[model samples]
Target: MTGKVLPLGLPLAIGFVAQLAISFTDAALVTRLGARELAGVTLALSVFSMTMLFGLGIVTAATPKLAAAHRSRDTGAVRTWYVQGAWLAVLVGLLGTAVLWQTRDILTLLGQSPSSARIAQRYNTGAAVGLPFFLLYVNARGLLTGVGRPKPVTWVMLAAVPVNLGLGCLLTFGAGPVPGLGVFGAGLASTLVRALVVVAVTAVLLGGGFRELALRGARLVPRPAMLLDLARVGVWIGARILLGEGFLPVLAFFVARFGADATTAHAIGLRLESLVVVFALGFSGAATTVAAWARADGDWRALRDLRSSLLLIGLVYSLGLSAVILASSGFTGRVVFGLHEPKAEGMLHKLVFLVVAYFVVDTLITMSMGYLVGLSDTRLPTLVVAAGYWVVGLGTGVLLSELTPLDFYGLWLGVITGGCVIAVFVFARTGQHIASLANSTTEEAPE
Candidate 1:
């Protein structure tokens, strides 16, 4: 039982590392281009992220369905779900691109400077062009993860990051005859690489990637019901994402009061947080895999084991990360934020403790929620995320900023406090569900 869960989970952990590597690569490369340039990339990435992640969540919701089909050994159903998911992704991608294309002005109104705004527009445009391909690739990963084939997704992700970084640098920094295109060039390169990854993953999957499973190719068509079901699940997840995103504006408002230095500090610290969050996300992805399989196989015992194992692992992992950040505060700040770079005043030690502290709580909560989703108990967690983030985090941050001397600390504390509350609530909820399941099973057995 333990082995089964671990094998499924390991790939998610590795895939997370792959994503971190990309961020690290981007930070390293973009640091050379100046603060404004770095900021441009940051804004560009955020806009692209907001658009892409919503679709990603929707596509991923199909995983459990695919897993259930595979467990029933229904090859036709699995194929139908997979195709339906891919087409849905493609459709969403196209629609998102059109919307973004029409709304570049609206994005600028979100507070990016003219230069950064232009870069964001270009990046968003390119990103939208790649969205269909990108989502198709992700759909393939969802299918693979459903059948316990996450290793391929992990490996492809690992390979893709280096490819993206190398190409991004070659284009942005200009190697040989290629003139440097700076941030915009990097965006273009990344978009192209992601498109290629999608194509490659699709080709491999279609060409007998999982021959043992006998996955069949089917005609691709829009299944309105499946699409609607995916959207139903997606809307909650999207709401969760939006609630989390809402904090950014509040944080931005708080940072603005501190002037540019504080704002830059906040942005840098947030990116640093992303590194830590990725690990929890890895565990979360594993939980999704485990939950999908557990439900498919109708093995509640396996589900319980997987959940317990993940929680234990996540606790230790998050604590260790927090300790590392505390211990190597200076080195980490220097390496990640270009500490030697001028104008980033009082960055080291000042924001380090706050960001790490926030990450510790945030990661735990994210992992717990991911596990809940795997159990097909998403509504409560989704509600918890929305309320905690908006009411507890954003509301407190805004009110305190107007009333106290806490400054950015108040904002960050709101995030940490909200996340901790949600974590505690969800942890308790998951425990009760498990206990109830155990009791029900015992009661059903012969005395």
Candidate 2:
């Protein structure tokens, strides 16, 4: 499992590191401006992440379907997945951009102050420009990833790191020949960097890479059946994202109620903690890639083994990172982030502790999602994710925060409790599923 998963995961994880560095750098750069500015940036980013869910869902739905087609040596089906997925991705991206443009109004409705809302609007507007392009990139990458050729995507991502960071710093702080544009500049820089990534990917798609996949024969129009097939699974995944990441704004709303300091601190805490979670996400992708291939190859035993191995790898990885966070977050809070204001560092420290549990469950949560997605089993996991993230997790947090003495701490406590619930339930669900598969095979065995 380690040998198989690490090669796939390592490149993606490295890509995530570059991606997280952009976030870290963005937060650090924005923080120098003001707490409110930091809060606004966080709000804008949360909106971006939320809006991209649909585009991401398209990729998820396309990946397994494409992989299955590839495995069976179904050239026509592969061409259909590739062609139809490209068109669908374009549609998802355009829609996503439109949705993101509404961020300011949403933020205002969520109770953010007028100044912060304006700042977020400015940032989001620039980010919106890149949405369609980013989704295009998603589809382009999906072509390769579905065929298990993901190392190139990692390389593309790593190359973008410097472009993203350098332009961000240049536009943000104003080097020679440029005016510092502050938070808005940071957003614009990201958009520009994403544009380059899109161009790079499109070049690959049309270049030798195209001939490699035999994409020359694929039509560039929507195939109704294929679109529906993709969307059947995609809608559920999007719902999961809408509910899971959608809770961010709700959580943000609660932090907003607390004050700017709390909101800013929470933003930092979330960004910092995301570093660890990204690794889990990377591993989840690996699991998905492996599972998709295994299923396509009719390797049920491999999937069963993968379940245990993914859990084992995820837990160990989660534990190691959690320990590092527990040990170093305080120093990182005060020194690395320079978050030494009253209650700022303390708030970050507490969030670090809270995220430990988040990561622990997240490792399994990510694995479960990957495991299920490969089986074309998204609907049940969608229910499970909704229960965990929205109902149990956020619901419990809101209850404790509102009604109990734990206050903010109560919210985190509830989140962890919910996480544990999710871990148990998802695993139980997977167990039943695997058992049924085993039983069916047993019954079908020759007498």
Candidate 3:
């Protein structure tokens, strides 16, 4: 199990880490511009992250479907899933871009200050330009992963890291000929890098990187039935993501009401926390592939082993990450993010512990989502996540942050509580499904 899961999971993990490095690089650079600039870019990125991730969830539906098709050697089905997924990516990407282009108005209506709104709008305009290309890259990467060709996609993402760093620096601060565009330049650099990486991955796909799974002769036309099938699965996945992962951005809005210092601290903490979350996501993707293949083969025992292995791996990884974060919290505040303000640095240090706790619970929810996705079970999990995040998590956080003295700490505690609730429900569902599979296998065995 480790051999199969690690081989695939490691590259996906590394790729996710590299992908996150782009954002980390952007944040580090923007921090030098001062708190207001950081706050503004954070607001812009909050909207962009929510929209982009929802779209990513939609496109990610292709992975397990494609894995099943590949395992069965159904070339036509693979082509259909990939084509429809790409089309879905384009459509969703365009919608997200439009929403981001209106960031200023959106932020204003959300009650952010006018100055912050303006800066957010400027940053988002450039980020919006890359939405379609970024989504396309995600779709292509999903296709490759589903067909067990994730290494090429990983390489493309790894190579994009330095490019984004150099470009982001040049564009943000500017050289002799170019004027510093500030936050806007950071957004533009992200856009350009996304486009470049997508083109590279697409070239690999078309240039026989798929090996036995050729995409050359596939029809590019939009089939209503195929699109509808993808949507049926993808929409729930998107909602699940929006409700679960999207909770953070919404939480940011609430955090914003406390003032810029609070907002900046929260944003910084969330960014660091996401580094750990992405690692879980890498494992989740691998779980999806493995579970999908197991389901296609009707191998209940393999699925059971997957569950056990995932739990063990998730616990060990989360602990290791928590230790690293605890040790480096101070340095990260003083140096990495350059938070010279004593209040901000103090807030960040406190938040790091909560971030660690939150991610440990979050890892369970994430891994369960991946396993369930492989089983093609999304609707119930979506509802569960919605209730956990909005009714349980957000409601609790709001009450605590607004009404109690815990303030910022209360908000994080609320988030952790909600994550714990979500982890329980999803793991229960996973067990029920696995048990049913076991019972069915038993019934089918020779007596």
RMSD of each: 3.2, 3.2, 3.0
lDDT of each: 0.72, 0.76, 0.86
* Reference-based lDDT, residue 402, model 2: 83
TM-score of each: 0.87, 0.87, 0.89
Best by TM-score: 3
lDDT of 3 by residue, 1-447 (tens): 767777778888889889888877887889999999898998888888888888888888888988999889998889888888889888889998999999999999989999999988988888898888888888887777777768998999999999999999999999999889899999999999999998898789889546566788889999888777777888898889878876775688888887788888998888777767888888888888988988888788888888888888888899888998899899988887778888878888888889999988998779879889888888988998888888898889889988899887788888988898889987788788778888888898999
lDDT of 2 by residue, 1-447 (tens): 667777777776776677667666676778888999999998888788777865787556877777777778787887788777777877788888888788889989988888888889888787788877777766666666667677777788788888887888888889878889989898888889888987787667667855656666667778888788888888887787576655554676676766777776777766665666777766666777677777676566777788888888888888988898789887877777778786767777677778787778877787777777767777877787778767887888888888987667666676677778877887887676677667777787799
Model 1 global lDDT (CA atoms, 0 to 1): 0.72
Q: Which regions of candidate 2 fall more than 4 Å away from where they truly are?
A: 23-39, 169-185, 206-210, 252-269, 341-352, 398-407, 439-447
- Clashing residue pairs, backbone N/CA/C < 3 A, model 1: none
Q: Which scores greater on lDDT, model 1 or model 3?
A: 3
- Residue ranges of candidate 1 with Cα displaced over 4 Å: 20-37, 169-184, 245-249, 259-261, 340-351, 398-405, 435-447
Question: Which pairs clash in the backbone of model 2?
Answer: none
Model 2 has an lDDT value of 0.76
